[model samples]
Target chain A: MLDANKTIQLSHGGGGKEMDQLIKSLFFKAFDNPILRAEEDAAKLQLSGPVAFTTDSFTVSPLFFAGGNIGKLAIAGTVNDLAMMGAQPEYLSCSFIIEEGFSIAELKIIVESMAEELQQSGARIVCGDTKVVPRGCADGLFINTTGIGRIIMPNISTQNLSTDDVIIVSRDIGRHGAAILMAREGLELESDLTSDCASLWPMVEQLIAANIPIHAMRDATRGGLAAVLNEWAKASNVGINLIEKAIPIADEVKGLCELFGFEAHDLANEGTFVIALPREAADGAVEILQRYGHCEKACIIGNVVETHLGKVVLTTPWGSHRYLDLPQGELLPRIC
Target chain B: MLDANKTIQLSHGGGGKEMDQLIKSLFFKAFDNPILRAEEDAAKLQLSGPVAFTTDSFTVSPLFFAGGNIGKLAIAGTVNDLAMMGAQPEYLSCSFIIEEGFSIAELKIIVESMAEELQQSGARIVCGDTKVVPRGCADGLFINTTGIGRIIMPNISTQNLSTDDVIIVSRDIGRHGAAILMAREGLELESDLTSDCASLWPMVEQLIAANIPIHAMRDATRGGLAAVLNEWAKASNVGINLIEKAIPIADEVKGLCELFGFEAHDLANEGTFVIALPREAADGAVEILQRYGHCEKACIIGNVVETHLGKVVLTTPWGSHRYLDLPQGELLPRIC
Candidate 1:
């Protein structure tokens, strides 16, 4: 048993007795699985065919926030990457870099949160490493999760978008970046303006099951919807005409953006995603997406066009158009 | 092209135009491959059969070290984990969490170092993520590498040791820890004492190719030789009798251990590993390992025994015997 009065020490990450105890008592117990319990340096996975491998490091400040903590975000972020690639989220590797004196109870809560989030996608954290730095050597804690999944659908790519494709927004965007900003500023907004940080595997899985010919699907993470759209436009060498009025944005998020002098399109999102597929499948994809609780505001926001190659043209409600270029400056650090 | 005069900004990790430029101009160029060039959310890999999955986060202080930098360490560490499981090093995902204002030149050097090290195992970095935190939120930069490999020799586990198995040390112990200590303490020992931080995939591949029936193999990383032997003992429920005289220790490492009041077996070894196999294969395995320049010090160090189950006993040169316990407390932080 770990002492309540004691905090994380350098010894806990030294790969010896203390590390063994910490791993067995906390990580092993929380992520109890046959593969992980095998206790080898690496996890032996029985994977076959094509697999999607992705990695992300989460250094979100204020480990706990409005909707989810870093642990939940870590699992969802990497799993979502795999899911967006039309793969079934299967296995994850969680690594932690902790600062000395970090609270054990908080660590436990964060770890439990990871286990809870893994249920959404059935992704097991099979292998992990923990390293503890001395005080002030790092922030509270940083987590890196790498995921590998079996690709159920192949060739869903950023470069696959064509002029016949219609772009759809999975949900209202910018909540994740707004929520992190609010948390950092210690804002007490009376509205339920939580970060839209949830596992996106469920919605992606549904889209795959429905046999939607998804051309490209990406979560609008750090640079938000604008980044994904711009990258898609450039990669596919097609023009994207986004209907600004049709894009979903929560009132609270808009208000925060107004106050912060930022654009909702440029804000980060954890759960929100953008999909490009043929116009015929657009309505069906939106219909399936809106069935999910978090994706109620899903709608068709844009369509691919032949003109303005490699550019995203946004038409405002006032009928004026502007190039929705890739975001340039930093909107919010550590949003994920 | 990235401006040579500018340092890394938060926008470099913001998933915006700046971030994409940084990744393409630096990471993509250094780790160039068709899969990586595709720039999908996740890398699509065609893998079959049983595979090994592993992850490691490198937060080693002094990014530049005696023998290698953090980039080399990150690649080698994760690759070695897969190799230890008798897996052929294949694909890797590298994620970087950088502090704002980190030197671009340093980053380039580190990345090139990673590319250089990848040649040892022929593993390609297939997918990655980059995040930049605000200044002071982290050290200069922390790298997390997750690897996937196909299993060549399955069921090589820490729990597979038997009384008939003999243990062999790959090389001299404690060089990594001693090197780090020397660098940190600014000790110019009039001796060429560099870290043993080379990739072990070549040696591991040779061992597998030679048809060595390796029961278990593990790198003496964070907790070093003592930790590996103790873990093998407990995991297999077999006693290990170690010949202290036969365990190779460099003179400089011995001097450092004496000066720091530490045991050589308790210090970290980045490139050294221990192998447990049947006594009949011990000489063959050692010969194969010694063919490599770094593994010149390879020798048999111990043998599994029936007495003192789950314990490691050391026989000293003077005929004195003692229990070699698993390391406890903070031996040295960030020795990796």
Candidate 2:
């Protein structure tokens, strides 16, 4: 059994009795399931047809934040990637690189958070690996989650976007970026500006259930909205014209962006996503998204156009237009 | 484009122009394939029937060893896990957590090594994620590879072992651990000892082609040969009697183990594996394995029995017997 006060040691990752005890007492107990309990080198799965596979490594600083920790982010990040491709999140493999001397209690909290987040998408941690480095060899902890799911709605790709497609914002953007910034700077914002970090699979599943013909879907993470829009435009060989005023931005995020001389559009969002679909289905998708409390502000934000191919053009509230190029510099490191 | 002289910066992982350029020029060029070039959040694969999913995080110290580097180990480690399950290594998802200020030139070498190793199994790097942390947040780099392969031989479980089953080792043990120790300790033993780091898929494919009924197969990795034997004994609820002299150990590895006061059986191996099969099929399996130069020393070293259930009993050259318990305490840190 792991002692709460005892920091992790090299022996715990030595592939011996100590490692076995730690895995069984901590990880296995937290992410328990028959597939994982099978204890095979690999988890046996009955996957068929087209499968969506994705991977993400979370090296977020200040492992824990106001609304979520690296554990929650790791799970949601990979699950959301599969969901964006219209895949039903099913099984995930989690790998952890831990720093020696890290607190056992803290690791427990992170593991529990991951278990809690997996519930939102009904995904299971079917397999995993753990490695512990000497103290200072790594920061507190980093997690990598690789996920595979069955693609229920096939052919959803960035290149599928068309000229007349409508772009929808699932929720307010920039909260995750701002929240992490605040935590790192130790700012007393005196506001409930937690990260927009939550599982988006439930809403995605509902959209699929409603038969929305999604052309392109992506979660706006690092480099945020600007990066996603620019990538989509270039990939689809179409231009995206966005109304700057129409995009949702929470007040706290806006203030933080202004104070830091940062653009809200380039700030990351963990739970928010952008969708491209036929204009006719845009309202229906928004309706389903708004049904979730967190996505109550979901609305139309832009439209795809033939002009300015391979570019994202933003129409400002002042009736001016400018190119929103892909982010070009370091905005913030380890923001998620 | 990445300049060999320039070190990796935070901007290179900021999900922006710099990050995109780095990926396209380095990772994309090395692991080029249609599936990877798809540029979606996840890779879409046509996987069918029963599949095996496994993951590993490589934090091997002294990144470069006598026989291979971390990149080779990362790919081979994950692929071998799938191969051990009688699955053909197919698709792999790679994720990297890098430390800022690390040399781009070094990273290029590692990436190229991964691409080269993938050729042995024909497994494509379909999808990946990259994150760079500020200096000192990590040692140098850590790579996580999650792999999936279709199971060609099912029911190959540790629990499948029965009384009188033959146990065979693919090659000499402890080379990997000794090589790493030499690299870290800066020792010059004037020996041709190198880590047994290699892709086992080619040899495994031949065994499968030869119709070897493997009851259980596992690569002796972190916990080494001792760990595998003990785990098998416990999992199968059967006893294993091993002939001490029959277990292969290279002279250099034995010297290093003796000098360091370590057990060769408890040291790690990147390429070595142990297989349990019916007594009648042992020779065929060994014959098939020996065809591969790396596994030329493949031979039976033990047998399953009803006595001493759930334990591994080692018979020494002098007719002495001792229980080979699971390795205890830290043998070596970051030995892959």
Candidate 3:
């Protein structure tokens, strides 16, 4: 009878034994925290001082496709975002919008993958909400993860921005973009282009431990470096000048961009970030990120400039200049 | 030049001006919070002590149908969950899973409706995330809202079920069921059987303000009152005896149940709740809830029993007894 107990079914959502099995064997096995294992309707936590809060939704298509599926992405995405602000990743609340006909086995696999990600990142999904839609309302599965991180760091930032900041990227641009192109385009490429998706908090903690005045940082997910650079420029009311040759891009991405009439710069990136640090700490920040897996290709891409307000200009390989607009709309949809 | 702006396109998810227009005209107009006004990456809040955190996803079919649409449902669903816990609804994070080829006009309408609900409920959307799927992958749109409320009341319990506790429902059953059935079944019933879906936090706050020992509470959504009752019965390790004849169900729902082979008790409800209160506080709780729009049909449907453990039985109108098992599956598949 126990051997016959199989994967999840629609009936589990019906709130029966199937639901119990899914919760016990699947969710519980993957995530077992005292607060989560309490099996309460909500999680209760005691907070002391200031808190840094963040949330994100992942709707990457082909739920179990190449690189990593939606489940792993959901955990890493929110955790990495919190880490960017140097917040200790603590409790996460998860919600799923599932289409009715999605296979239960696939759901289990995704959950298992997420479990591995959560374990490595030291985060617990304390509460979760699930909703199923008719076949049409949603893609196979869409996940929303809301994270709560305690501000253990004394001085992260309080809207402090200045002109003497150098912009540093944790890693090479377009590895995630190149990998998505290979997977989405169904290519058999010689280059081993895998997504650089991993937690950045460890690297962030290392920098914080080093006592660097990291002004502001953003994970370059959707619009890549262009979107994040332009956003920081507008927020801090400064300009960014990029040395096109100094910026990192894989040869494969450049090739793919040429084939699809797309610019590699505008493609989506998941693992890297655009960080503004003091000009003096540029060397130290670059060295720290280089030691981490996420930033093996780390480099000083550019710097926050005092001159042109709200403008991000890229120096072309030919040594001329052009204004880099925040790619008006999404380039490759749901790359995250 | 103004007329050149025609409608929403795939690029809106790409984070463009049309997306800005949609947010400014629909969302910002309704949710005017300082954090959202700045449109920053995350919402920053300064606070102390414990916080109540909750998240819910809305994946109703056709995005825009009868009674209320996805937008209002998303806002109302999260706000109501927070209210059930005796928390003051404060910050909300909204995430959207939008399908390719969805009508721009429909998306706008849903956002506007959700915004209106937020304003009415006094909750602000502090952050937002958006994702888009390919054309055949999704129906139209799905929304997930994560809610965080400051825990004003110190001690509230999900395991507060005692032998002498009374189970009180906020209002009539199956209003949302009837509305969805009409929309899906294309029935033209000449009745104002609109969904009972409004924010329930305000209704809950009115009751909590009276200083009553609220043992357990839940919004009778997806699986309805029976499921919640079953959960309480198990959590509190007690038996529940509910008289079927005393339960309040609309006449129209009863009629529809007869035709569709659906049980009035099993039908999904959107804007209702079942609260387990101290035996002494039952009368006061009922009186307070009735003063609000949600509990006009409120009643003491059942009482907690000390003898039998983890069981919920109902006395039928015909003097027969049946174990009110937790719902085994979706009653109105994807009704929410």
Whose TM-score is greatest here?
2
Candidate 3 is graded, for docking, as medium
Given the true complex, what DockQ would model 3 score? 0.53
Best by lDDT: 2
Give TM-score values for chain A, per-prediction. 0.98, 0.98, 0.92
DockQ of 1: 0.82
For A1-336, candidate 2 gives per-residue lDDT tens digits of 689889888888877777888899999999999999999999999988998999999999889887999999999999999999899999999998999999999999999999999999999999999899998999999999999989999978889999899999999999999999999988845778999998889999999999999999999998899989998998889999999999999999998888999999999899999999999999999999999999999999999999999999999999999999877688888988
- Model 2 clash number: 0
lDDT of 2 at B196: 97
Q: Give the better candidate number (1 or 2) by TM-score.
A: 2
User: Model 3, which residues run further than 4 Å from truth?
Assistant: A1-9, A64-66, A134-137, A152-161, A328-330, B1-7, B62-66, B318-320
lDDT for residue B299 in candidate 3, whole number 0-100? 88
| Tens-digit lDDT track of model 1 for A1-336 | 876567998889887678878999999999999999888889999987888999999999889989999999999999899999889999999999999899999999999999999999999999999999888878999999999988998978889999879999999999999889889998946668998888888988889889999999999987889889988998889999999999999999999999989999999999899999999998999999999998989999999999999999999999999999777677677877
Off by over 4 Å in 2: none
| Pairs with steric clashes in candidate 1 | none
Model 3 agreement with the true structure over A1-336: per-residue lDDT tens digits: 112234333555554565566667767777778877876555666766666677788877556444677888888888887776677788899877666667767887888888888876688898887665556556677888988776655343424456878788887776666677677777735566667676777788888889877888777887788877887788778888888888877777777778888776677776677778789999998898899865777888777677888888888889899999887655676676
For each of the candidates, the C-alpha root-mean-square deviation to the true structure, in angstroms, is 1.5, 1.2, 2.8
Tens-digit lDDT string for candidate 1 (B48-88): 89999999999887888788889999999988999998899
